[model samples]
Target: MENKIHFQYLIDGDDFTRAGEASSDIKSKLKMMNINPDAVRRVAIAMYEGEINMIIHADGGTIDVDVYPDKLTMVLKDTGPGIPDIDKAMEEGYSTAPDNIVSLGFGAGMGLPNMKRASDEMEISSVVGQGTTVTMTVLF
Candidate 1:
């Protein structure tokens, strides 16, 4: 594609049923565009992890994706009670989700770790009481 394509999605917090919609949609779109399958899979996984985090932690959030010929970029922004410790949050099996969330089969503390693993490049920014934004990119 010569021009960049953009998409925006609104995530509803605590809504497990629709948590993966955005990622699914993006996957389909990428496939339709004949993008690389591996890149699409990586983007889907990273985006899905971010969406789940927005639902379990932040009340809700917005995700913006930009598709380019050689790369895909995803921006997940949430207004939740921002992460207290970035280093700790990045650790595998480290999660702050409550017991109730755990029972639902989520909040396994693998969200961020998985996201990082799937994306080629990732960056996170947060303010203690305000919110957080995670930006991830996958190169094709």
Candidate 2:
């Protein structure tokens, strides 16, 4: 591709049924674009985890994805109760998800970690009471 392709998605808070829609749609779009399969997988996994996080913790958010010739970037922004400790949140098996979400097999405390692992690069910014924004990039 010679130019960047962009996509935006709105996540519905507390809606497990619609949690993965954004990732799925992005996956399909990437596939149709003939993007590298591995890159597509990375984007899908990372974005899906972020999507689920929004539903479980942030009460939904907005995801913006940019597809470039050399990489794919995803920005997940939420206005929910922001994370108090980003370092703690990034650790595996460290989750703030409630019992109800855990019961549904949604929160295993691996969301951010998995997102970081799947993406080539990841950055997170948050304010304790305001919100959080996560930016991730995967090389194509």
Every candidate's lDDT:
0.94, 0.93
Q: lDDT tens string, model 1, 16-67?
A: 8888999999999999999989999999999998998999989989999999
Considering every candidate listed, which one attains the maximal lDDT?
1
- TM-score of model number 1: 0.96
Q: Kindly list the per-residue Cα lDDT of model 2 for residues 10-112, writing each as its tens digit.
A: 9999679888999999999999999999999999999999999998888898999999988998999999899989999999999889999889887888999
TM-score against native, each model: 0.96, 0.96
What value does the lDDT take at residue 66 in candidate 2?
Answer: 93
Root-mean-square deviation of every model: 1.4, 1.4
**Local error of candidate 1 at 32, Å?**
0.3
Q: Global lDDT for candidate 1? A: 0.94
Residue 17 error, candidate 1, Å: 1.2
Candidate 2 weakest ten by summed lDDT: 12-21
